[model samples]
Structure formats: structure tokens, C-alpha cells
Target chain A: MANIKGAVVVNKERCKGCDLCVAACPCQVLALQPTEVNDKGYHYAFMQNPDACIGCASCGLVCPDGCITVYKVKL
Target chain B: MDINEIIKPENMVYTKPRLMNDNPMHYCPGCSHGVVHKLIAEVIDEMGIEEETIGIAPVGCAVFAYNYLDIDWIEAAHGRAPAIASAVKRLNPKKMVFTYQGDGDLAAIGTAETIHACNRGENIAIIFINNGIYGMTGGQMAPTTLEGMKTSTCPYGRNVALNGYPLRIAELVERVDGTCYVTRQSVHTPASIRKAKKAIRLAFENAMAGKGTSLVEIVSTCNSGWKMSPVKANKWMEENMFAKYPMGDLKNV
Candidate 1:
């Protein structure tokens, strides 16, 4: 299978740490980083495993705040 | 290749809808209102109707819906969105009009307005968000509260005998003579979100075509109101809520 790398950009300020994106990610590529807090004092979601993302946009789709953006590239 | 070069516009798959404002939403974390609001903005952007579109905001959690969408909006009295939207549509027949209402505002206090508007077949779209409980009022039991569902008001769980059965507004509206399209959807999953966006787009198109009243009920979740995590709330909604309010088209005339 061709390598399909994906990337996700999270607008940390906009994210309320709802973690809906973490649950919606099918590949388990997302996680709410506990160590880092954004300006909003929330532990926002991060792409813990970017290579595993399939660019499904599931995380972005379920996000209430429109905080996550997804991109893909064929390698 | 530079990382910046790879992150070009052509590589973008998904981003926030342009019609949505940059202001942070006041919705609770994991609240379905934000997702539904984004969908509405996307529909308006896709249809290029922002200029002619007028939204009627209800007096619920979505009362500030006007703040999120960059369009003309009128804050209607509680449950009076449909009545106001009807007037707007009648005065500006060429413009697109819609009402964003919650279960408490639509299925309860606005029940008569909702039914009469549909019965008259007003040329407007109604985006109904049915999260079962009244989230704005601290999760009180609503007209659409599921049987045996426990809310703040119904601490012992809703009893059909006293609270009455959960109103199936979509189905009821579908049966109305003037309704041209009616569908129940959700935004929990990607596929469901796509379907919902399609339904919303169709509702807008129907309104522009003057087909009749189009009602799209989004069976949503209230994680904070439900006293559960966002993830659990979605699962609970899928298992419990969907049973009473199945997702699909009730009518497409």
C-alpha cells in the first residue's frame, strides 16, 4: 500500500478540550496532551501519531468548535 | 521540501467554514450546537446565499447563533423563531430564511408555531436540534425527552403517564400538508455529518425553490447536561436516543 501520511493542525485557543476529536479519530492518531495547556487553560487535542492518520477528517467533522484542520499527502 | 510548502492550499482537506465567525462559541465543550452551527454556515457558504440569507435565532442555547454566523439574524422570542421566519420569508420571498431552534424552543413552547408554520407550508427551512433535554435551563426535561430518561427536572426518570411521550416532531411535521422535506440526522460520525450537510443543503435549496417548509431535525447530544463525557454522550445517544428518534428521511415531497 502506498504510504499516505496525514497531518492535523489544531487551533489550540479555539479548542475547549472536549476530546470529541480524540474519540472520533478512527486510527487513534489523536490524543489530548495532558502536559501542555493552551491559552484557554485546556489540554487541547494533538496528533500523537500523525503517520497513522488516514485523512478521514472524522476528527474535524465531529469538532464543535471547528478547531482541527486535516491535510494529506501521498508518499 | 519545506514544511510550509507542503502545507499549501491545494493540500488542505478540511478547514473551518468561511461563513463561521472567528469568535469563540459559548457552547459547552462537546456540545452538539457548535457542530450544527458549523453545518449551517457551511450550507450557507456553499449555496452562496450569505447575502440574502436571514437566520432567526431562538431563545435557547443557540440564542447567540447570530454571533457565530456572519449573516443577518433576528433574535426571536422563545419558540417564536418559526413565526418570525415565516414573516421574513413572506416579505422577502427571494431570500433564504431559516430558524435554528432547540428541543425546548421547538417541540415544547413553540409547538403550535412549528406545527402551524409547517401546516401553512411556509417557504423556509427549520433546523431543529433535538438533544432531548433543555441544555440552556440546566438540563431540564423537554418535550422530546426520551421515556424513562432522567433529567434535572425529571430526577426519577421521565414517566409517560405524567410527562407524556417524547414528541416525534420530524414525523409529525412530515405528515403536515405543506412540508416538502423532512429528515432526522446526527453529527456524531463523519458519514453522518456528511449526510447531515447534504440534508441541510437540500433544505436550503428547497426553500430557494419555494417547494415548501423543510424541517431537518438533528438528534444531538448534551454531554454536560447529561453529566457524561463527550465520548460517552455520543455512545449513549447512539444507543438510547437513536432508538426513539431514528435517523433518516421521514418525507421528501
Candidate 2:
């Protein structure tokens, strides 16, 4: 497979930490940061492995709060 | 690579809809209302009707819909969104009007308003979120609650003989002559959201074209109300709720 780099930007404060986007990510590229808490007191999702993201936008699509934004680059 | 460079317009794949205000939604984590709200905002923005659109907010968990979507909104009494939307559409025929309602508001108290509006062929759209339970009221059984489904009120599972059967609102509304389009969709997955967005866009277009009433029923999940995690709620909905409500276009004309 071609090495494609992907990036995900999560609006840290807006995320409710529902974790729906974490489950929706096909590449297992997202995870809820256990140590970090947002203003909402929830462990928001973060990019654990950005390079694996395919820019499928699945996370953004399933996010209820529109907190996730995805970007990709083909190397 | 710097995250900033990746987020530049040229590399962007998806961004929040501009029509959606920056206000954080109050819905429970993983509630379907937020996804549906985003889809509606996207449709309104894509249609360029943000300036000429009015939304009727219902008295459910989504009562704050107007707060999230930066559009003209009128807060309606419980179950009165359809009626309010009817009046709004009539007085402002050129403006695109819609009602955002939940199963409790729509199928219970607002049932009459809903059927009457559709039967009258009102030029408006109805976004019906059928999660089968009254989330704001502590997960009480709603008119559309599936049989054997356990809820706060129905702690031992819904009894069909006592609670009656679940109301298939979309199917019922589709039979009404005034309805131009009706579809049941979900927002659990990427493909589904795209399909739902298209359905919403079409419903709006139909309303603007004076094609009578358009009802889009979204079979959604209320994780907080369902007493399940967001992921499990979605799985349960797909396996159980979809069997009863099903998904797809029930009517299009």
C-alpha cells in the first residue's frame, strides 16, 4: 500500500467524549486520551496513530458534535 | 508534518458546517440529535437557504436546536412544531420552513398536528427523530417505542397489549395525499450520513418547489435514555429497531 499520511483535528473543548468517532475509525487511529481532560470534564478523542488514517472522514461523519476534522496527504 | 499545514483548505476533507453555530450542543454524548443537526445545517448551507429558512423547534431534548443552528427559529409548545411550522410556511411562503421534532413530541402529543399538517399538504419539511423513548423526560416509553423494549416507564419491557403497538409514523404519513416525500434514515456511519444529507436536501428542495409536505424520519439512538453506551446503542438500534422501522424511502412523488 502507498504510504498515505492522514491528520485529524478534534475540537478538544467541544467533544463530549462520546467515543462514537473512536469506534467509527476503521483504521483504529483514534483513542480517548485518558490523562487529558477537556473543559467539559470528558476524555476527548485524539489521534493515536495519524499516519494510518485514510481520510475516510468516518470519524467526522459519525461525530455528533462536529468536533472531528480529517485531512490527508499522499506521499 | 505540522498539523496546521495539513488543515489548510487544499487538504481538508471535512469541516463543521458554517450554518451550525459554535455553541456546544447539550445533547448527551453520542446522541443522534447532534448528527442530525449538522446534516440539516449542511443541507441548508448547501441550498443557500440559510438566509430564507425558518426552523420550528420542538419541546424535546432537541429543544435547543435553534441555539445550535444559526437560523431563524420559533420555539413551539410540546407537540406543536408541525402546527407552528404550518403557520410559518403559510405566512412566509417564500421562506423554507421545517420542524425538528422527537418521537414523544411528534407521535404522542403532536400526533394530531403532524397528521393534519401532512394531510393538509402543507408546504414544509418535518425532521422526525424517532429514538423510541422520551430522552428529556427520563427515557419514558414513547408512542413509537418498540414492543418488548425496556424503558424507564416500562421497566419490564413494553407490553404490546397494554402499551399498544409501535407507531410507524413515516408509513402512516406516507399514505397521506399531501406528502411528497418520506424516508427513514440513520447517521450511524459515514455512508448513512451522506445518504441522510441527500435525503434532507431533497426534502428541502421538495418543500421549496411547493411539492406539499416532506417528512424525513431518522431512526436514531438515545444512549443516555437507552442506558447503554453510544456504540452499543447504535448496534442495538441497527439489529432491533431497524427490523421494526426499517430504512429507506417509503414514499417519493
Backbone Cα, N, C clashes tallied per candidate: 0, 0
Residue pairs in clash, model 2: none
The per-prediction CA RMSD against the true structure, in angstroms, equals 1.3, 1.1
Q: Candidate 1, residues B107-193: lDDT per residue as tens digits?
A: 999999999999999999999999999999899999899999999999999999998999999989988899999999999988999
Per-prediction TM-score: 0.97, 0.98
lDDT of 2 by residue, B1-253 (tens): 6666667778888878888889978899999999999999999998898899999999999999989999999999999999999999999999999999999999999999999999999999999999999999899999999999999899999999899999999999999999999999998888998999999999999999999999999999999999999999999999999999999999999
DockQ of 2: 0.82
Model 2 stretches astray by more than 4 angstroms: A1-3, B1-4
Q: Candidate 1 on A1-75: residue-level lDDT in tens?
A: 236666788999999999999988889999998799988788999879866777778899999999988887776
